[model samples]
Target: MVNAPAEQKKLPSWWSGGSVVYQIYPASFKDDDGDGYGDLRGIINKLGHIKSLGVDAIWICPHYKSPRVDEGYDISDTDIHEPFGTREDCQELIDAVHAHGMKIMFDLVVNHCSDQHAWFKESRSSKTNPKRDWFYWKPPRMIDGVRHPPNNWRSCFGGSVWEWDEHTQEYYLHYFCSEQPDLNWENPETRQAIYNDAIRYWLDRGVDGFRIDTVNMYSKYLDFPDAKVVAPETPWQPAGDFFSNGPRLQEFLREMRKEAFSKYDCFTIGELPNTPSLEKILSYISTDAEALDCTILFDLADLDHRGGQYPLMGRNWALSQFKALTAFAQQLAEPEHKAHALTYLENHDQARSVTRYASDAPEHRLTSSKLLATYLLTLSGSVIIYEGQEIGMINAPKDWDIDTEYLDVNTINTWREIKHDAKVQNDPSLLERGRAGIQLTARDHARTPMQWDGSKNAGFSSNPDAKPWYRVMESYAEGLNVGAQEDDPNSTLNFYRQLVSLRKAHKDLFILGRFQLLDPGNDQTMLFTKTALDGSQVAFVALNFSAEKQPFELPIELTARQSQLLISTLGKSSESRELDAYEARVYLA
Candidate 1:
């Protein structure tokens, strides 16, 4: 397998490609300094807790200096955010992560920079400035009698990607919010600068590796073509195809690897979205590739959504489609591909899987969460566990005021847009739909403060009176926090811990064995078997994706083999049903 570099090969099992990763949204994790926000010191304090989960590495979302317009993805500088901590605090976190026998991955945002960044400031200061070509700046086109953006490209957040610069009398492009401008990768100086400052700087600081943000979006065509009109009512259109995986993508990646990553013993997981071709996705992680070791895809994450995270567009996803996309990713483990992938049901950008993928009703919450965990941990690839997911956290109540409580930029934008549309159309259904779907695709659902205990502020903030950046889920007081699950043997938290151990105990079969997806036509249960390459053993896995009981028989390939139960979400099922609601079982033969 293209798992590790020569030096990394000598390290522990977790250092390999199959290592489990725990992702922490630092702003909502814990407020150790009592500043009403989570900081590096808080992560340092929780190293033991994360280590307890048997994770090989921790990927803390961007704590970089920013205006917080897009939650630190818009970087003003490469330095650590003051609210989060200092450069010394970052170093301390790296030391602490290593001391706890785990690696740390930084979020690298090379696609864009905050408008206030010195580079952007210099670039936009004057048309003749030396750094003027470092970012995308275009002259507005005349539309009838009014000036309009150069193209119909829409910002990922909302509205036009080209923002008017009254001072410069030109428009600069931002793939996200207007404050975050896309960098020009065509310029060698820009590429070299990022390589020197962002890439090598962290590697020089003893950090393990990185989770490169939007890795495929680094390059773009300079011609600046107009996008197809998908939604005529909207001022801008979805122009992802025009900017993603551009011609120079591979060349730039190879250059970055040669100039930085190849020089260090590190690991990298790229955040690659809007990429649908499995062949293109595999190329990056292929055994012969010269770039990243692994990549995270959004193919399965947006299955239930209609227009890529739009409000009130949630739709029921077919189990067959989910299985096919899932199996497509598993192809990385094939001998021909010889690559690796990371599996997860939740991340920093989506609502909790307990509510989105499975029933969050009191009756099914625990088993359903465990069911997802079983599916995640039993795969042949590395696993990623988001914060609070281990305890079966669900979405916040929809009645919360969007203006005051839902403070996320995307959430605020969506709320305002839908609210205006509702009023203009003289139909209250739009606003109602937005509220009804708040738990469906709102980014704020994923940004809620972590629930550590049942105490004040859910033990996230030491001060009982401090109002944290986001509202803490009130359910924490009802035995949904880690403190309550820490000692409960049957809790979802403990169940995840057990599954982690189970995966490690059979790493050979779980990580390197062949992934045989069985019963592809079944609409309720996900049934599969991992067969050791040597044909000496096989582990059969069955996962119920519904709240109702399901009956299933093992495929003939595994039916006659005597097997021992390795793990099950519903422990020692007493029900007459063969597979209890949301039950998952793994048996090794």
Candidate 2:
């Protein structure tokens, strides 16, 4: 247990109430040593930029040693990766973020480890090994003359979740790629190791908190039953029914809190996907619950899709649907709940939000970016802004080659599978449509390197000849880079900066207020209000989701004389309540 030093007495929790977290996908953030990959050193240098954003915390994605099979989530060891720098560099980052008056949250991916991890190595060596039970190793079932996996569970990357081990003559379960094997959380020793070695290790290193990756999947259905048939196209099916929010989930989280988290002055934000309902979420994050401080919710992110987090599965979302979800989300902000809502639109695992949620076309991109930013900032929660989101980054251009520029494992597997399905079905249009959908929803869109300037490499790396690990959005090199937007008063980056400041000035309304989602059934306009719990402050927010102008009236009997204009995306306050294309305005009502 690492107690907070007297000098850092306030470190116990700094992420609640009006705190905005700036998420850094480290590899794509910035490269300090001309290595073409962003690292801890790069983040250390960018501390000023983060502090200037008016954010209180920074959530950095995985930097641990890995085989790079799943973009660093397949961690091999808890040690800092050599590519990201050394353990000392990580410590420096933690200290640097503190020195800049911001807390740092490390990405904790305890759901699985790389196949090359020492524990996995020892577990797979022999059936009698002490660590044999450290990972899920099950005997294969014999069908006819051939051996088959224990069940029809599918991996997140789209295949059987079980991989056969030749030497052991058995199969190991992996919810993701075969290279990333699931740790046996059912084992007490394994759970202890995760808490003592990984969770507590970073806490002791002085990291302010953690953004736990896939926290809900730690426990599993002991029976490993065949997953229900969601897609009959293949035998393997999504095993969410058997694994998500498993029976022992709360017990494990309570134990985790007692074992490590509660002992330290830190916070934890869980990556909790497949949430059944708001009630389920409240159970995880409510003040009385000994679980997560906050959870990365997906209700808003999942609105534009049929399948959760899977690419090429697209669906058109109604503005009413978006309004309903946000309204549903507001239940967490009630005083009775005492739950801190961790809200976001973009993250490393998903595509850019501006492209998915709003118009990203050149004509509407800027206005819509501000519109979405307004929506995100005004929500009664701690907002998380993805890297490049402030400058309005969009999806990868359609002309870009999927086979070359795109590199996410999920994107690659889905692309190949769709190509095969298209060819077998002899539908060229099918392939074209698949390509378009994949391009539109690909994770690679978020994985693109940061655009800092108009340099050859978008100023991400010092050496112009050193190519970034991923492609930079070429169109952004000119006007959309930070260097350009930083100077433009009306730029998306500046607009975000303004909103952050405004939110802080009125934290009572945004942070401790009761949210009332109004006109939720309106297909074109979204209107909401956040009133302080003590009724001291009231904030009225109006947004137009459509590209064309929309007429909106305040349901409440109010006029320009009764309200104070705070800020507007159109850069001017007007007596007219009519909303322009993609316009957003907040009023002190």
* RMSD of candidates 1 onward, in order: 2.8, 2.2
Please, what are the lDDT tens digits per residue for candidate 2 over residues 457-503?
78888777887888788867647788888888999999999999988
Can you write out model 1's per-residue Cα lDDT over 229-338, one digit (the tens) per residue?
A: 88776777878788688888888887888787876777878877878887888767665777777888887887876464353357678787888888888877766786
RMSD of 2: 2.2
Candidate 1 wrongly placed segments (more than 4 Å): 1-14, 306-312, 573-577
Error of 1 at 513 (Å): 2.2
The estimated TM-scores of all candidates read: 0.95, 0.96
> Global lDDT for candidate 1?
0.83
Best by lDDT: 2
The TM-score of candidate 2 is 0.96
Which segments of candidate 2 are over 4 A away from where they belong?
Answer: 1-12, 306-311, 557-561
